[model samples]
Target chain A: MPVISYIDAVTQALQEEMQRDEKVFVLGEDVGVRGGVFRATDGLYKEFGAERVIDTPLTESAIAGVAIGASVYGMRPVAEMQFADFIMPAYNQIVSEAAKMRYRSNNTWYCPLVIRAPYGGGVHGALYHSQSVEKLFAGVPGLKIVMPSTPYDVKGLLKSAIRDEDPVLFLEHKRCYRLIKGEVPTEDYTVPIGEAEVKREGDDVTVISYGLTLHFALKAAEELEKEGISVHVLDLRTIIPLDKEAILEATVKTGKVLIVHEDNLTGGFGGEVSALISENAFFELDAPIRRLAGPDVPAMPYSPPLEKEFMLNPEKVKTAIRELAEF
Target chain B: MGSEESVMETSRHEALGLSDDQVLEMYRTMLLARKIDERMWLLNRAGKIPFVISCQGQEATQVGAAFALDREKDWLCPYYRDLGMMLVFGQTAKDQMLSAFARAEEPNSAGRQMPGHYGDKRFRVISGSSPVTTQLLHAVGVALAGKMEKKDFVSLTSFGEGSSNQGDFHEGLNFAGVHNLPVIFMCENNKYAISVPIEKQLAGGSVAARGQGYGMPGISVDGNDPLEVYEAVRDAAARARKGEGPTLIEATAYRLVPHSSDDDDRTYREMGEVEEARKKDSLVQFKKYLEDVGILSTESGAELEREIGHIVDEATEYAEQAPYPDPSETYTHVYAE
Candidate 1:
């Protein structure tokens, strides 16, 4: 086992996949030569050269369309949108073209495409930089939404998404890029696309979260461990085609469920998780299902205080779980 | 009575060394496309089909472009109204009917998408959807792959004058130009996008003029003349194979019928205008060329017409009788099984 940062793990997966399969290539603005704006694709251009590591123009739709085209023509394309918010211009291609390709073609054509974007708040990255597009993309069928909280999950899931027969949206929390580090094996491995992991196991209350919020939930569970209360932190690694069975299992075990996310509460992934739990495992729940999410606003603001208010702190998660238990 | 000389064809299709038989084959494909489009409309009226987007007056432009490409090696990303190009690219009359009928046997989509959304992998026809110009981007991407792999294949994508106004079209052509990819962008400027004419759609007044900005050679041809279109696309395909770059071709044709069976052309344009355009119909022009070349006669033309009608009849019957896809199949392809 080796400790690597979340960004490093993504780089490793891309490097390994490209080395193993020549068909796999990367294309986006500032990806080649620049090694990506965040250096997520560092050293790839040097290792693979300009041909495989293509530098595209500033057209997001073309970038996505090229990926769809290349994917259909026996090539695996990993396209990058500089930021999650900027992906709006390319959404028509991803959701309309790439997502519906297989179904529209009766499975005669498949787009083995992966669109990677850095999402979520907490780094004080204003409106354009700190948005989470997973909730927007999760509504689209034929697309897998993979949001990893740790380096190990990022490495494993990025590799799996590359080899998937269909399209996938790989969202990496920008705050977790260099902050989160974990042990990843040197041997070949993959994290299955539609599975969830319980980061910390407990009995009293189950807190379901993903991306950076999962870490908050884990910290809350740890702080509560010092007390007599036990809390289970369920990390939903893949949001779309959500690990329903894992959610039901956590519901059955804890009986007190709390779903949390950094996205606004109105139509967040937490809403879907809560709906599933209430629909499938309602009788098993001891109390009403709870959610701790960002308030309904346009986006994460630039001011630190406003941003902090928008984000769910570990202490807040702790308080929410305590209230759930009291109920 | 000494000797009667039939009007010799001085057309470019003949000058390009296409024998009368080859030219007649082109005519046959164009005729097949027109007949299939006509039949689909009939079905829509009879309540057997739901929609129809016709390639009525653009046969010469589409068939001629497909004729110039390497049928086995080159790829096509045809728009919704590309029945002529599909027929030339090996999509059969039955294939079009299956799609129109939206049955289980439909090769492109198994009763999932609407009619005119065409795609078949075997013919190298890239799948297309209803979004105006998305296929243009896909064609460029496929060409970029071929360029990277050093393949001899060229990708030809077609769209309307209206679609050329889409951002996808600009992005695709610009990207193709930057990379010097093996792509041929064919704009079938059919005078109208639904009801809006070219005057309202284009500011430059010429679609080909925009090609200079993308650094590719752009040419406009008479869509009513198949030979002129064949020459233009043939040259573009050659340039693509030589790795020179992409070429933009504006093939101006008329939309003989309404946009679809659902549209009422009388509300926007007069029947007098359609009748005026019908005199320059490519189908009639190409048939005259075949007759003048001494390869076809009144009797042979009528015979081919009968043969085409029978094929359409059989395809319609088979497709109409075919079953709709199972209800469970709706969820199957949404993700990998």
Candidate 2:
């Protein structure tokens, strides 16, 4: 095992997949010559040349459409969105064409493509670059959404997403790219999708989170453990087809639930998770369900104070967990 | 003497080397499309079919462009009004009826898509969605694959005059132009996109002229003249095979009927206007041309119509009696095995 940054894991996954399958290619703005805006695709162009490592124009719809067309023709295309917020122009391609390709064609077709987009708040991305787009695409059928919080998980999930038979939206948290570093195994492996991983085990309450907020839940659990208030932190690696069994098992064991996420409260993935938990594990509840998430604001502002106020942290998670456990 | 002018004057189809039988076959496909559509509208009014999208006045453009391509090699991404194109591209009369009836045997979509949403792997006709211009990009992708695999084929995608205003259209063409892919973007400008006329739909004038911005040759052809459309598409396909970029073709026609059975045309256009356009219907004009050129006589025309009537009748009977899909199959295709 070697310690690597979150961004390196994504690059490693892309390299490994392209090497493993000759049909796989990469395309996005600055993905070739400039090595991507975040350098997540660094040096792929030099190794694969122009055909495999394509640097596309700034049109997101065209980029998405081209990838879809290629994927439909038996080519595995890994498209980059530059920024998650910029995916709106390509929304039609993803929702109407890519997501519905397999269904509309009635099993005669498949859009087995991967779309990697760096998303999250913090680092002053402000409004446009800081959006978390999982909520927008989670409702779509024939599509998969994955958000990894650590380097090891990101590497495994990216590799898995590329090989999946359906269109996968691999949302990489921008803040985690450099900040989150962990040991990634040198040997090839993939973390299965639709499975939740428990980062910490506890008996008092089950604290569910994912992406950046999963770290907060873990930190809160660690701090609570010192005071004998045990907390179980579960990271939902995939949003769609969510790990229902894991969620039910955790809720059954803890009897108290608290959900944490960076996205706004309304219509977030957490809302769906909470709904699933309540419906499946209603009888095991010890307290009313609580959520520690971003406020229902439009977006994070550039101002540090306003952003800080809007962001969730370990303190907030710890407080929510303590209150849920006590109740 | 004008050097460019030839002493011999002939119909455009004759000049394009269309044999009498082939032209008649094209005419037959167009007539079949119109007849089937007429039947669908009747079925809708009689509360038999759920919807009706007629190919009424634009049959010539559909048949002509489809005839220009190599059906076995080339790919087609047709719009909702391409009944004639689907027929020419190997989709049988029964196959269409199965779709119109939305029966389980519908190969285009397996009873999933609407009637005119064409797709068939056997004939290389790529699948399409309800969205107006996404198929344009899909066609480009087909051409891209053709280029990548070094196949001697092109992809033709058709849309209405109104859909040319979509971002997908622009993006699709821009991509095709940049890649120099073997693609022919045929814009079937049937005057009205629902209710908006061509004048209101495009402020920049001709859809063909916009091809210049994307670094491709743009052409405007008479969609009512099957010969003219065939020549335009034939030349464009040649250019694509020669490693030249895509060509934008604006085939002008008229939507003689309302947008769909659900629409009423009176609020948007006067009946007199529609009647005037109907006078230029290719169905009537092409038949008269064939008669004048001595290619088809009154007896032959009647004979062809009777043959088409029989085919449409048998297909209608088969489709109406076809089985509907089971409820359990609805969840089947959402994911792969």
Candidate 3:
């Protein structure tokens, strides 16, 4: 076991994949010489040549379209958008071309590619730098979505996404890129996509979260433990083929559910989870499902207090859990 | 005709490398395309197919350009009105009929899309999107891949004069120019974006001029002249194989038919305007050239016409007899796995 940060795990996955497959290559803005703005691809360009680790122009649509074309012609391309917000220009390619390639072609062509982008807020990154585009992309079929909050999961999921037969949106929370560290394996390993991990199991209530919000759920579970409220924490690593069974099973046992995420409370992934439980596992529930999420605004200000106020902190999760416990 | 025919005159003899047999073949295919347009119009009138875009006057441009490429090796990403090109290529008449009928056996779209949205992965022909210039970017991508893989394949992508105004078109040309990708961008300038003519939609004098800023060769060709278009595309494809960059070619053709079966040209333009276009018909010009060279007689042209009419009729019967797939077939081709 080796202690590694989330960014290092991403780099490890890229290095290993590129070494394993000759078709595997990286292309993005500032990814070749600069090694990415967040240092997620540091030391990769030096190891690989300019052909494999390419620095493209500031055109996200070209990056996405080229990745798809290369993938169609028997190459595994891993494209990167500097920020999730900048992916808007490439959304047409992602949704129209990449997502529909397999379906429209009747699966004769599959876009085996990965698009990596740093998402979420709380890092003083202005409005344009932070966003959660998973929901927007989730509506598209033939695409997988991955959001890992820890170093080990990042390495495993990134590797899995690269080898996937379909396109994947690999979102690395910019807030958790350096803050989270875990013991990641040096040997090759891949955590399966579309599976949820039970970070902390408890019998009282379940707290479902993903990405940066998973840390807050765990912290809230710790705080609630002092108040004699045991909380089960589940980390939804992938969002598209979301672990609906795990969610229903966990909510059935705990009898109370609380979904947390960094995205806005309105029309968040939490709503999908809450709707699933309410639809399928309503008979087993002991209390109403609740969602603790960020404020319904574009993004928060850079000031410490404003950022703190905008984020779903541990205390808020604890309060929500206590209130649900009384129900 | 000797080599001194650059002034665009009607010559007695046929051009070199263009036999009367080839000219008749092109004419028959164009006639078939016109017939398909007429059938689609009748179908729309009788409440069958929702829409139909006719490629009547620009048949020479499509057929001649398609004749330049090897269908098995090269790729084509054609816009909506390229039935003539598809016929000239290896796409079977039954394939076109099935697509037009929107049947499960439709080799192009499989009932998932409309009639004109053609695509065949085996032939390396990608489906055209409804969006105007986005497919131009896709064409660049395909060409870039071909170049990177060292494949001797040239990608030919077609669009309308209206699509040239899109930003994606400029971006695609810019990328192709910078990377020197193997792509031939053909602009089928039919003079009208539905109702608004070229003068209102386009700002530049000619669409080919935009390629000059991207450091690529931009040339204007006589769309009605089949030999001229064939020569231009042949040269472009050869240059692409030699690692030269993209070329923008604007073929100023006419929309002899109404914009679509739904549109009525009587409201916007005069009948004299269409009669003027019919005067410069490619079929009549090529036929006279072939007759002058002794390669074609009036009887031979009539016989060829009768043969193509029989083929189109047989293809229609085959499509009509080919049973429409059951509803359950809808879920079959959605995913391979």
Candidate 4:
């Protein structure tokens, strides 16, 4: 087993998928010669050449729209959005075109597209670069939103997304790109798209989170264990087509739940999770379901103190966990 | 010289390499599109169908451009007003009626989308949406795939002059020109987009001339003449097949009817203007051409109209009697099963 960073896991998945299937190609700004801004597609351009690793002009809609067209033509295309914040220009393409391709065509056509966008807060990337854009697309039916927290999950889920028959929005937490490291096997294996993983098992409280915040929950769970508080941590690997069974089991096990995310709290994905838990496992609750997330401000500010106030760290997760457990 | 010019004008289709039968077929297709569109308007007025977007005056442009491409290999990403193109690409009158009726057998969307949202895998037509210019990028993507797979197929997409101002139109054409992809961007300049006239819609006053900015040749032709449109598209397809890249074509015509069934033209434009444009209708002009070429006599023209009338009548009856999709089917095809 070889330990790799989350970004390395991404590069490995692209390399393996492109090698295994000739139909799989990569396209986005600077994805070719420059290898991508984060270098997530590093060295893929040199190996696959320009035809497969296309460096497109700086137009998000075209990147998404063109990939959709090629996907309908029976090619698997992985399009990069440069940053998740820039994905708004391609919003219509994703929602109206790619998402509705199968339904509108009545199964006569489908878009096998993977739109990889680096998203999250915590870096000094201010308003434009650092943002959680998952909630914007979570409500869309035909799209599969996957945000992996670990290097292993990143590799497996990306491979699975590429092989999936429909459109998948693979969001990579930019902070976790190099920060998270884990062992990834070289063999071809996939972490199924719509499954949740219980990273730790305990009975006192349950913490549900994903992406970089999932790591925070795990760390908080470990620290809480020494304080005689047993916390169960569940990583929601896929947001849409949520693991209802896992969510119910995790919620029922501890009866106290705290959903954590870096996105704004008002209309975040946490609302959906809270609804699911309340609707299904309300009777089993020992305490009111609590949510720990960023404030409902428009975005993360540029100042470090303000940014820290908006970001969720391990200490915050630990406090949220302890408060729910004591209640 | 005057006699020589008259001789050339009489045999224009022959000079363009169109055999007598092919020109006759073009005339038939144009007439079929007109009759079907007219029937849809009547159905809409009768409260049978919900909406109708016509291809009334632009039939010549659609049929001509469609005939230039290899129907079996090339892909079409057409906009709403492309009934004529759909006909030439293998979509039958029944297919159009099924869509108009929003029936379960509708090949375009199975009653999911409204009529005029054309798409069918069997015809190699890429599905389109209500957005103005999104299909341009889709066509470019299809051409990109053709180039990548070493296939010699070209992709053609059409839109209104109003759509040329859309960012997608710029983005699609720029991408296609940059890669030298085998795609054709055809702009059916129908003088108005909904209610906005071309002068208000286009800043430069010409959609075809904008092609130079994207490194492609832009050509404008008479939209009422099928032979002219055919010649332009044929040359453009040849350029695309030779890997010479895309071409921008502007077929100038008038929208003889209002934008849709819901729109009332009297409020926006005068009847005199529409009646003037109707005089240059492609069906009338093309029939005279066929008559001059000694192909279609007055009796034959009447016979052709009767033949098309029967097809439209049969299609309408079949679609009207077709079943609606089961409610359970609404959940299917959102994703792969």
Candidate 5:
């Protein structure tokens, strides 16, 4: 095992996948000789020719549409959107074409493509660069949405996403790319799409989180353990087909639930997860499901204090968990 | 004669083929397309079909360009009013009728889409959208993939002249030019985008002029002449195969009908202009040119029309008898996984 940053894990996964399958190619702005804005695709163009690691024009819609067309014609394309915020321009291609191709064509077609976009806050990237819009795609049927918080999971989940027989929105948290470094296996492995990993198990309360906020929940769980209030932390790697068993079982064991995410609180993906628990295991809950999320503001800001104030952290997660555990 | 005059004459007669049979075949397909529209119009009026955008006057341009394409390999992204092109590209009259009637057996959409939304992935006809210029980029995308894969396939995208005003038109062509992709952007300059006439929508006065900015060759053709459209597309396809990048082709044609079955044309255009455009009807021009070239005998033209009308009638019978898609199908094909 080698220690790798989350961004390097993404590059490694792409490089390995390209080497393993000749049909896999990467295209995005600055992905070729320039090696991507975040260096997630560094050395790919040099290792494989420019054809395999392509740098496309600035048009996000073209990049998405080209990937879709190529995927339909026997090639797996991984398109990067520089930042998740820029993906709005290509939303039509994602929502209309990629999401509907399987159903509209009556299972005769599949968009075996991956759209990799770095999202979320904490890097002072201001408004346009930091957004967690994975919630927007959670309800889309054909698209599998993945948000990995650690280097190891990013590598494994990315491989699974590329090999999956459907279109996937592989959203990487830009803020966690370099901040989180961990040991990742060099061998090819796949983290199942809809499974949740228990980062830290306890009996006091169950804390469910994903993407960048998973770290905060875990930290909160560890800190709360010192206060004798043990927290069971669940990291939902894939948001679309959520691991219902893990959620139900965790809520039943702890009898309390607290959902955390980096996206804004209202209409975030946490609402769906909370709703699922309420519908499935309502009587098991000792208290109402609590959700601690980023302030309902328009993403992150450049000002340090404003950015920090709007961001979800371990303190907020701990406070929410403490309140829930007492119930 | 001056060089420009000779060139114009040659360009105008570009439709003139070496033999009579070629002209007759072109005229036959145009006749087939015309009859299909006639049948579709009748169906809508009789309440058998919901709506139709009759490709009455623009048959020559659609048929000619489709004939120039390699139906087996080349891809086509046709707009809603391209029933004529759809027929030429192997879309059976039965399949068209099934789609027009919103039946399950329609291969284009399997009853998932409205009529004229042509989409068959197996045939390389990328699904079309109602958005005017969106399909232009999809064409460029297919062309880009074709170039990258080193495949011997060219993508032909057909859109109205008004689509040139869209950013997608500019972006698609610019990308194709920048990458030297094998694509042909065919602008069916039907003189209007609904009520907005050419002058009101376009400041450059001609759609072909927009192509000059992209560094690709641009050609203006008499869209009413099937031979000219065929020659222009053939030349453009050859250029694409030779790695000469994309070409912007403006087919100057006329729209003799309203925008769609739901539209009223009297609100938009002057009756005089509509009358003037009717004189340049593509079918009429092709028929007259066939007669002038001795390709169309009076009996042969009537015989072709009768045969096409029978085919349309048989297809309508089949479509009318075919059942609508089961309601359960609505939830089935939304996703493969």
Candidate 6:
């Protein structure tokens, strides 16, 4: 076992997949020679050369569209979106083109593409940089959205995404890239998509989250353990094709539930999770299903105090968890 | 009328390296597309089909461009009006009929997408959607894949003149030109993007002239002349296969019918203008060229028409009787099984 940063785990997955499958290649704005803006695709250009590791123009639509075309042509392409907020320019290509490729083509054609984007707020990245865009695409049926909270999950889920038959939006929480480090197996392994993991098992309360907030929830659960509050933390690694069975089980384990995320409260992914729990496990709830998320402001602000107010931290998660547990 | 005139007419196809039978086949495909499109319009009028986007006036360009490609190796990302292109690339009248009827057995979308959203893996035709010019980028991707793998294949994508103004048109073409991918961007400038005429659709008033900014040779051909389109596409394909990069082709023609079954051309344009455009119909012009070159006679042309009529009739009957998709399978294929 080797301990690796979340960003290194991403690089490992890409490198191993490219080595394992010759058809697998990478393309994006700075993915090639510059090794990606975050260095997530670092050294891929030198290893795979210019053809395989393509440095594309500044157009996001072309980045998405070209990856789709290559995937349809039997090539596995991993396209980087630089930042998740910038993915709007390529929204049509992803939502309309990549997402609907298989369904619209009557299963005759499918796009096996992985669109990687670094997302989340904090570290002072304001309006243009920080965004939780997964909710915008969660409603789209054909797309699979994966947001991992650890190095191990990132490695396995990304490998699964790249090899998956359909389009997968692999969202990396930029805040978690360097902050989260965990032991990952040096050998080949994969964390399956659409499955939720109970990171901390308890019976008093259930905290479900993904990405950076998932880490905060885990830390909150650990600190609350000293106070005789048993909190169950579930990491929803894959949002789309959500692990409904796991969600139900987590809710049943503890009747009180608190869904946490960094996205806005209204129309956030927490709404869907809350709806699923309420619809299926209505009687299992000991308290009203609560959701703690960013306020419904347009986006994250640039000022430090305002940014902190907008983002979810361990302190916020601890308070939300204690409130749910006591209720 | 004279022997010298006959020789000149025959030489025109020969100079393009087209044999008599091949030229005749091109004519037949163009006519078949026209007949199919005409039947679809009738079906729409009679309420047998839900919609109709015609290839009536642009068959020459579609068929000609398709004929110039290596049918076995090349890929196509054709628009809704590329009926002739689909036929040349291996889509049958039965397939088109199934698509038009939105039957469960249709190869395009199995009743999911609207008719004319062409796609068939067997023939290497990439799937398309209603948003125009997006297929251009998909075609470029296929070409990029081919180039990356060192494969011998070119991708051709077609769109309407109105689609040329789309941001995707700029993005797709700029990417293709930058990468020098083996793709052909053919703009079927039928002079309208759903009733907005060419003047309003194009800022420069020319689609081909925009190719210069993308570093590709752009050419405009008469959409009514199948031979001219064939020659231009053939040269473009040669350049693509040689790694010289993409070519922008503008084949100017008229939209013989309304944009779709839902549109009313009478609201936007005069009936007399449409009637005038019909006189220069590619089907009528190509038939005359074939007859003048001694490849077709009155009897042969009539026989071909009768054969196409029988095929369309059979296709329509079969599609009408084909079953709709079962409700139980509505959620299938969203992801791989």
Chain A TM-score by candidate, in order: 0.99, 0.98, 0.98, 0.99, 0.98, 0.99
**Candidate 6 per-residue C-alpha lDDT over B231-288 given as tens digits, one digit per residue, 9 for 90 to 100:** 9999999999999999999999999999999999999999999999999999889899
- Which structure is stronger by DockQ: 2 or 3? 2
What's model 6's lDDT at B69? Answer: 98
lDDT of 3 at A226: 89
Tens digits of lDDT, candidate 2, A1-327: 799999999999999999999888898899999999999999999999987888776789988888888788788889999999999999999999999988888788778899999998887889888888898999999889999999999999999999999999999999889989999999999999889898888899999889999998988899999888999888898887589899888888799999888888998888898898788788899887888888899988889998888888889888998888778
Instruction: State each model's TM-score restricted to chain B.
Output: 0.96, 0.96, 0.91, 0.97, 0.93, 0.97
Q: Write the per-residue lDDT of candidate 3 for residues B1-337, one digit (tens) a residue.
A: 5535544643322443655567667667776776666666776787766677777788889988988787788888788888878887777767877776777788766766677776778777776656666677777877877876789899888989998997667777887887888999999998988888888988876999988988899989989877788888988999999999799999988888888777888888889998998888777776676666556788987887777667767776777677666777666543236
Better of 3 and 4 by lDDT: 4
Candidate 1 per-residue lDDT over residues A44-78, each given as its tens digit: 99999998999998999999999999999989999
Which residue pairs show collisions in model 2?
none
The TM-score obtained by model 6 is 0.98
Give each model's whole-structure lDDT: 0.91, 0.89, 0.82, 0.94, 0.85, 0.93
Worst 10 residues of 5 chain B by lDDT: B9-18
lDDT of 2 at B270: 91
Full ranking by DockQ: 4, 6, 1, 2, 5, 3
| Candidate 1, superposed: residue stretches over 4 Å from native | B1-11
TM-score of each: 0.98, 0.97, 0.94, 0.99, 0.95, 0.98
Where model 5 places Cα greater than 4 Å from the true spot, the runs are B1-19
Ranking by lDDT: 4, 6, 1, 2, 5, 3
Q: Of the pair 3 and 4, which is ahead by TM-score?
A: 4
TM-score of chain A of 4: 0.99
What DockQ, on C-alphas, does every prediction get? 0.80, 0.70, 0.51, 0.90, 0.54, 0.88
As a whole number from 0 to 100, the lDDT of residue A163 in candidate 4 is: 98
| Candidate 6 lDDT tens digits, A1-327 | 889999999999999999999999999999999999999999999998999999999999999999999999999999999999999989999988999999998788999999999999997899989998988999999999999999999999999999999999999999998999999999999999999999999999999999999989988888999999999999999998899999999999999999999999999999999999999999999999999999999999999999999999999989988888778
Q: Interface RMSD of the predictions, in order shown? A: 0.8, 1.2, 2.2, 0.6, 2.1, 0.6
lDDT of 3 by residue, A48-113 (tens): 887788888778888888788777766888999999989998988888878777767655666888
What are the per-residue Cα lDDT tens digits for candidate 5 across A4-66? 899999999999999999889999999999999999999999999788888887888878877
